[model samples]
Target: MTRPIQINNHPFRFLLYLEWILLAISVITSVLPHPSPRFASRFPELAILNLTIFGLMGLRLPTSNNLVKIIYTACGISLIFITGLFGGRADRLFPFLYIILVIRSCLIFQLPGRLSVTFVSFTLFLTTLLYRIPRYPLPPQAQEKFRFFTLSLALVFGLSLVFVLILMNTVLSERESREKLAIANEKLRQYALRIENQATLEERNRIAREIHDSLGHSLTALNLQLETALKLYQANPDKAQSFLARAKELGSKALQDVRQSVSTMRSNPLQDKSLAQAIDILAEDFQRSNNILLNRQINLEYSLSTEVNTAIYRIIQESLTNISKHARATEVNLEIIINRGSLYITIQDNGRGFDLEQNTTGFGLQSMRDRALSLGGKFTINSAFGCGCQITVDIPLGRLIS
Candidate 1:
């Protein structure tokens, strides 16, 4: 990934401000009066150094992009060679610009890349020293002063260069850290959003199942009673009146059931009731609606999260629904157990089951599995053609502890 540079960072701004300050100092020292060499002889070089600094200031360098960076790096290398060339005269002030050139390099190069520039600077400094040494036509007195000034500048320049490189290393390190942290935070945000969406979908599915099971069953029975009342109106008015009364009662019950399901969807009543209590209510309702034997053995003394309670309720509710609609079973065994920090439940029916391969997605099996897994539980079904069906849900208590 491409890590973008932020010039506004405090460390980066500090480096920029230091570069400008060093530039100002180099300019002031270069223009200082030179008594021994004659000011007239050094004036031209000083003027050119000032003009070069001005030119550099106007040549806008990019803070990003590899191509622009390469061009800027070449410009810095050129400045180093120019400083070495003109700073040669023992008494001249131009060599002070070496610090400015080092600063220029610090702007463009990262760690270890500066070592290449450092090597180049050392080679050029040595060449300048050789040219300024005694073998030239200058007097020994001048040559001695030249060696002293030249050697000292080299030592100080090398030290200052290393220091600047070290500072730039810190800036680069901080930049990388900021980028990594930003990326990690972004990933965490996306994960949180996914979790929220999944919760919403599960809730919507639960509401849908409640409405289908409650209203569908009630409305179907009401319609049959009304049709029977219409047929008996001519033959037996009293019997027809009884059928009409039953239909009216069913209609009222269906309306109340719908409102109750909607209210439960809005929030969990199970929050006030433990899983055992919720399952007890579910068992009584299932037995009344389906006219099937529902044997219960629930004993959850400890409270689970509302989510776990809701999942357990929905799974049992959906399983009972599937049995009434398709299982053709008259009796079902419901058992809940806790052992070794695990919650296990078994819902088995002596219903006419079908082939596993052919009926893979029927009987609301997929939804029951999804609900169980969402609670960090395992769901399994055992059944075959003409045999009974059994659904087992196993959840570790560790998942509920949190």
Candidate 2:
């Protein structure tokens, strides 16, 4: 059989120990060598009653429900009243009453419940006063002393109530701070996940474009050359040999192109240059390789943080790949600008455009939006049937660019 693990050390337990020490001191002070015989007789009973209530309070400290707490409080208050009545020293019980009031205030309750507890405590105090003055025989000189004692006890109770309220306020404030921190951490995790997914999608789009541009074009040319070689193999043997050689050359070029594409895809550009320079290099490469007329316009010379630069570069790369694959047009324009502490990027294509609503499952546009949103940015795509597509991204400076 396994024994239960004992991990009893905690801050709340330490506080309870401190409270017990304080209660012991209060009991010792109230009981040691009282001048009045009646008060002396009641001291032991008062101490035992206080100890019992303190034990019950320790048990109830972890509870938060109003009904259960009210029950415990009522039991403790009834014991206090009974001890006072039997001991015939109402003034001696005021300290216990004050402590009970403080415990009652700590209960998790609405305004109505708090007011109800306050009313019950006040009623008990008044009832104790009425029970004590007439029944306990005293001289006129002793009565003045009793009045002063009652006033002092009342002041102590008021101060104790204020202290309890302040403690409760501090507990509530700490709890709120913890909750806010948890929510902020959850949001950050979600943002990071979105960025990861966008990066994956961009990698896939680049691979697809490479297959279409290099491999597909090469295979088409090889098929055409083979067909021509078959038609002229006997009539023009030399021409047939030349056609086969050209087909072999195309095949070799395709393999080289695939190797180069894979090598460049694996390189990390953001490690060496600023985001602006990286984007300029990408635009330059696209213009050099593709037959489509590429017009690049960068209107700003702003610096971005390393992570923001990488995200931006990936978005632009994905956009260019989409244009190369689907946008069958003659011209494409790319623009980058910084306005009001935000990095804005626009990629426009003068190609046949598809409906944004109809192509919602297309990963390219979704990936672009996810990339922008991950960096605390806004992404918008505007296009319609027969018109070209324009993607606009604006990332906040405070969140990403800074």
Candidate 3:
């Protein structure tokens, strides 16, 4: 992409000031005394014409059309030629004007276009030098020195032009790369914010579902049992006592479910515990809450980062919670191992599974999947009706530590 040159802006004001400074120097030199008095009258008019063309070129610099840039460059070349042909001490001013043209070309063109302008500037300098060579005739001995001096000057001027072109190209390329990186970083930041908000919303919904599905049912059942006990208090004392006992049990169960939901909401689930310790605590809680027999084969031979540790803990926690809530199974298989430079985790249950095609995007399952993916891991689920559900997560250890 091209950037327009704003002469008043901070980026382009320095260039504007430099251009004016160069022009002032050229004008001052044109009015100074020179050995060649006949060229004096022509200097003032040539200087005025050169100044006018330079000002016009600056005004038209913000255009992107190649045709306009070519015309602008042509105008600069013609002015340089006229100044060299008639202005006193034109040799001193020719290089500066040509350099200025190259600078302007950079603002309007890409690398290929800039290179073309530099080549033309070098060629024109040579042509002007040759045209003015015969004006000062010298003896054979002095001519040899003059020719050597002339060739050296051309080489030096050509090198200077190439240097300026390369410098401008490097600066512009660096600036472009930085701009692209900044845009990419901004996009990433926005995406991260969206993901965070989505996660928060999903967590809120999950808690609401737990309260409605588990605690709500228990409290409703408890209320009915308490009402039944009240109704039978005078009719039958034994029946009323049994109903009161059942109501107390339901109330305790509802309280336990509420506690579990609150525990899940903790900011740091691990709480300074290692992955194995955290999993053991979770297994104990699962066994206490449900009748399922958990068979764990955990071999965490390698240490893990906090992020990985938390992810693993949450994935397992979420899986067990799902199994307890939905899976009517007597047994669960939990496996975790660091094998072949990767961490592998698999949680399977002998529960009556649902259709994978129809229930592929549950909130709990999605939360687990997102956790795995954020760490550059893979998460997959396999299940069918009457068949047990299986979830496998594989994460590269090298990626985690880095």
Candidate 4:
């Protein structure tokens, strides 16, 4: 696999420049002052050639192909062989070749490939040592000098490899951490957006329910009174006058109710009443207005949090309004039960019912289900032609009943 090149930070770049400066100084010190014409001509030329290759490697050119590796290996082998031909005098610069090989291995290869390059470089160093020992005579003073050179070479190569590996691992670790944090932040944003949308939808449903319950019913009652007055005017003048007066009174009351419903629907109603109480008021008003009997059986007394209460009340109000408008029912039954950390509510009407599956897309039923789901609740409706409609809502207590 081809690895991307990363530009190092200022401190690391400074260290790299320092290494190149040191290599230049070593080459200059090894070559100057014209020691024997044959040694001077050949050795300095070879040292200059090796330094040039090191400079090229530092530029960080692309190495997706094996051409760069072949060039680097050939240069390394040539420098090692040339230094060996010069014997003990040139052997002092062997550490430079080791340093360059280790760095090139790290840049060109990943961990496993770097290890293979390291093993090969060490083998070449051993071969150079064995070749030199027989040609140079070991005097007592030169024995300690040879040992020092060997130790220095080992220290430079070993320490450089260890430090480079540590630096690469640290960079990889930091990159992975940043990626994970980015993913987590994205998920949090999505969750927050979902919550905001649900809140807006619940508020809209509340306003719609208030319109149907308070304003819609009153307007319908006023309309009925007006129709009655128009009929009575031909039969009896006094009765028609009384009916007209009642119609005017009903219209004025309805206008007031409309204003009140608009104001309250904009704000929160659950701040004044629990969810169950809100449902009870709605059922009672509906019962009184339509002259229909309501059988309410509630076993739960717990008050839900404000938002949860608002959602539940809207759902119940919508279900009852649908019954009043379309069901043509004489009696409706409402049952609420809370048990084992679950809130269960069922509303049924003894009226002409339509197919639940086929007519599932009706506005009132969809609104009720949407309200229940917004609170993390489940809603189910069951009905068939000529049979009563039943709606069941089950909400987890942890989510809404608290």
TM-scores vs. true structure, each candidate: 0.65, 0.53, 0.62, 0.67
Candidates 3 and 4 compared by TM-score, better number: 4
Model 1, poorest ten-residue lDDT window? 87-96
- The better candidate by lDDT, 2 or 4, is 4
Q: Write the per-residue lDDT of candidate 4 for residues 1-402, one digit (tens) a residue.
A: 655343442213654675577566656755665556544535566666665665555556334767677566566666655654552344566655565566655556666766776676666776676565546578877988887877786566666656665665466457658879888988989988998899888667767756654465557656656776789889988977876776687688678866776666543445487666777776776775556788988787676678777777767767777786788899999988888888998999988999766889976677778778877889999887788899999998888645
Instruction: Compose the digit string of candidate 1's lDDT tens values, residues 1-402.
Output: 333333443335554565555555555555555566633234436544653563355234455676776666666556645654554232244344444455455555564546766666666666766664555478878878877888797888677767766766666678779999999999999999999999898778767655655565567667767887899999999988988987897799788887887676543436587777877876775675556899989867566777777777778877777787778888999998888889998999999986777876853677778778887889988889789799999988888653
Show the colliding residue pairs in model 1: none
Q: Rank the candidates by TM-score, best first.
A: 4, 1, 3, 2
Estimate, for each residue in 1-402, the C-alpha lDDT of model 3 and write its tens digit: 455456554345666778778777777777777777655636577766776677566754765677877887788888876776676664477787888888888877888889888999898889888876867668998999889989999999998998888887887788789989999999999999999999999788656544654565467567767887899999998988988987888799778778877886424457798888888977875764465899999997777788778778778877887787677889999999888888899999999988988987876787788878878999999998889899999998887662
lDDT of each: 0.68, 0.66, 0.78, 0.69
Full candidate order by lDDT, most accurate first: 3, 4, 1, 2
Pairs with backbone N, CA or C atoms under 3 Å apart (clashes), candidate 2: none
Please give the range of 10 consecutive residues that has the lowest summed lDDT in model 3.
1-10
Give the winner by TM-score. Answer: 4
Alpha-carbon RMSD to native, per candidate: 6.0, 9.5, 7.5, 5.7
TM-score of model 2 vs. true structure? 0.53
Runs with alpha carbons beyond 4 Å of true place in candidate 4: 1-3, 6-33, 37-50, 61-94, 129-138, 144-266, 274-277, 288-291, 301-308, 337-343, 373-377, 395-402
| Candidates 1 and 3, the one with greater TM-score | 1
lDDT of 2 by residue, 1-402 (tens): 222111252223544565566556555655566677766645566656665675556544424555666776676667666655554333465555545455445534544555566656666766766666656668989988988887786667656665665675577567658879999999999999999999888778656644554455456556656777898899999988888887787578667667766777433445588776777766665554445787877765555677677678778877887776677767888888878888788999998988987975666666677778889899998887789888899987777645
Winner on TM-score (2 vs 3): 3
Clashes of 3: 0
